[model samples]
Every structure is written in C-alpha cells, then in structure tokens.
Target: MDFEEDLANDSEGALLEGTGKVASNLSDREEILQSLDSIHSQINQELNTIGQAIEHVDAEELPNDIEEFSVGLSDYGAELSQFIDEYRHNLSAQSEYFETLSSEEADFADITDGIENVNETHRAMNAHWYELEDTLISMQEILANFEMPTPQEEGE
Candidate 1:
C-alpha cells in the first residue's frame, strides 16, 4: 500500500476502536443507572416505613420529653447528606468497559469509598432508630403513670 493509503487505514482503525469504547461506556453507564434506581427505591421504601412507624407519635410531647430528639434527627440529617455527597461522587465515576465495570480501575476507588460511606450510614441509622425506640418507650412509661393513682387521690 502507498504511505497515504496505509495512514488512512490506520486512522480508520483508531476511529473504529474509539467508537467501540464509547458504545461500551454508554452500556456500562446504563447498567449503573439501573442499579442506582433499585437502590434508591429500596431506600425510599425503608424511609417510608420509618415515617409510618412515627406517624401516630405525639410530637407535641416530644419536644419536652425527649431531651435530644431534635438533635438526634439533625445528626441523622447530616449523615444522610454525607451519604448523598459520596453517592454523587460514586455515580460520576464511570467504567470504560461494559463487561467489567465493577472491577474496572476507573470506578474501583470511588465505589469502595461510596460503599463504606453507605455502610456507615446504615450503622448510624440503626443507632438512631434504636434511640427513637428508647424515646418512645420513655414516653409510653410517662403515659402509663396514669395507671397508678396517688394515695391521696385514692383515699379521697
């Protein structure tokens, strides 16, 4: 082949290779999107469950009864915010290939950090839930005091 013809063939090969990579990347991104959608739905469902559990709770007494209920919720808010930040970082880190996206070098680091952050959030949320349960128990005890009338009242 003439020098120009050979050069033209090589350029075409390179273009084809790069186009393949772009297509592969788009497919990997779509998979990542699907996984994220499932996770988001699961989290939303869990949050809804928690909301339902707390729905009938009397919050009017919560301000006075639970010393740190508001503070605890604030801390939970911070943890959730941090989780979102890490999740954004993780999602932006995409793989170059469609087949091996999870193990790929491009996304491994961010994914690791994101998983850790998510794990931490799970732990924090669990602790907060227990804390809330304790608060509810205490409130129930306060309300239960009505079962025992004072001796003076009984005598009267």
Candidate 2:
C-alpha cells in the first residue's frame, strides 16, 4: 500500500479500537450500576427486617439503658437506610445521564465530557462508600460497648 493508504488504515484501526474501548467501558458501568441496585435492595430488605424485630421488642421489659440503646439503634438504622436510598437515587441519575449520552450522536468532545462526568460520579460513589464504611465501623464500636445477656440467662 502507498504511505497515505497505510496511514489511513492505521487511523481507522485506532478509531475502531477507541470505540471498542468506550463500548466496553459503558457495559462495565452498566454492570456496576446493576450490582449496586441489587445491593441496595438487599440492604433495604435487611433494614426493614431489623426494624420489624425492633418493633416486636417489649420496651417495658428492657432495662432503661437497653431501651435507650434500642432507640438509638432504630434511629441509626433509619439514617443508614435513608443514605442507601439516596445513593441508589444518585446511581439512577448517573445511569440516565449515561443513557442520554449514549443515545446521542456525540462527537469526541462530547464523549470526553461524558467520561469526565462518569469519573466524577465514580469518585463521589467511592467517597460515599467510604463514609458508609466508617459509619458501620462506628456502629460496630457502639454495639461492642453494649452487654447483651446470654440466651440461657435471659430464659431464667
């Protein structure tokens, strides 16, 4: 092939490779969002279950300190649940943004902008995840301070 033809062919190959990478990235992001949705659902379910259990607890039978602890647990559970819901909402918004970008006949600059938005979303998500992790660790510490009676002793 002539030099011009060879250069043209190389450019085409590179363009195709770039497009392929973008498509792959889109697929990966979709998968991550789906997984997040699934996790959010599971967390919501567990939180609801815990709330139900707390509701069933006989408040009058609990020691004053334990009763106060139960209230705190319920409040924290509610706050955590709200945070999860907000995270899921943000994910949905990001998904919609991606969908809009993908459906458009975007140029390189538009695609670059989309990628930047995705990166920002990722950073925000990571930060939120870390915050949640820290909150969970704190909750664990709080629980560690509490002294629960053994089942056998409770039966006495």
lDDT of each: 0.44, 0.55
User: What TM-score would candidate 2 get against the native?
Assistant: 0.48
Residue pairs with colliding backbones in model 2 are: none
lDDT string, candidate 2, 52-105, tens digits: 444554544444465455555566556556655665666556545544444336
* 10 residues in a row with least lDDT, candidate 2: 1-10
Off by over 4 Å in 1: 1-19, 56-156
Instruction: State the TM-score for model 1.
Output: 0.29
TM-score each candidate.
0.29, 0.48
